[model samples]
Target: MSDPTRFIPVPTPETAHFWEGARAGELRLQRCADCRKAYFPPRAFCPECGSREVRVERASGRARLYSYVINHLPAPGFTAPYAIAVVELEEGPRMMSNILDCPQTPEALVLDMPLEVTFERLSDEISLPQFRPAKGRAA
Candidate 1:
């Protein structure tokens, strides 16, 4: 039997810092040195200002549930009834990730609710950044 957790990410030079930070238990993002705009999915230049001057920075690990769907379809490495969510980070960038530590339902996964980043080690070199209900929020 194959392990679903075997799914691993291959990091490119532009996104290496992000994958490294996740393995070290931190959420890393890039900020434009000129516009000071933070962004994700690691690009060589700033998406907002089209500047090549960008640097990696640690994020606050806080986010809000922007949108999501409860996926009930079967896949290679995922179970049915999983919540695939788009979360807006505190740094103003949005990321797509799986919502963890909560039931995959509308009543439990409230929109605009607070979320906290949690890393799941998928392999030796990859740790996916997932989110869970923030402390004191209804699950």
Candidate 2:
């Protein structure tokens, strides 16, 4: 038998809105009311000064490549040979995501590469955020 397909999530109530926005093709982050810092992963409080007051805002969906790892092994229900990357968003938060829409190769994955968010619909209600080269790249 198999372990079955596992859906990964935070299981928290406060971050629901952020996930919803992702499903709708929009990047969402929290803005600290006290310090005015935007952060990702949808937290309940600010990481800067521990302020509970915050608000959700739309992100520009643009980021620069920070780091990445090319996975040769399959991850659960996923296929082998994928790139898991951390992208530093234009809004000042770094988030973990997958790089897609191109050939996953050593020459293709470069550090500090400019990227833009594009949604891959996993299900009717779930859209996974993936990144590709911003534009004008030879495939």
Q: What lDDT score is found at residue 56 in candidate 2?
A: 93
Q: How many backbone clashes can be found in candidate 2? A: 0
Per-residue lDDT, model 1, residue 114, is: 97
Model 2 stretches astray by more than 4 angstroms: 1-11, 137-139
Identify the leading candidate in terms of TM-score. 1
Question: What lDDT tens digits, residue by residue, belong to model 1 across residues 1-139?
Answer: 3355456779999889899999999999999999999998898999999999999999999999999999988867787888889999999999999999898889999999999999988877888899999988847
Full-model lDDT, candidate 2: 0.82
TM-score of each: 0.94, 0.87
lDDT of 1 at 26: 96
lDDT of 1: 0.91
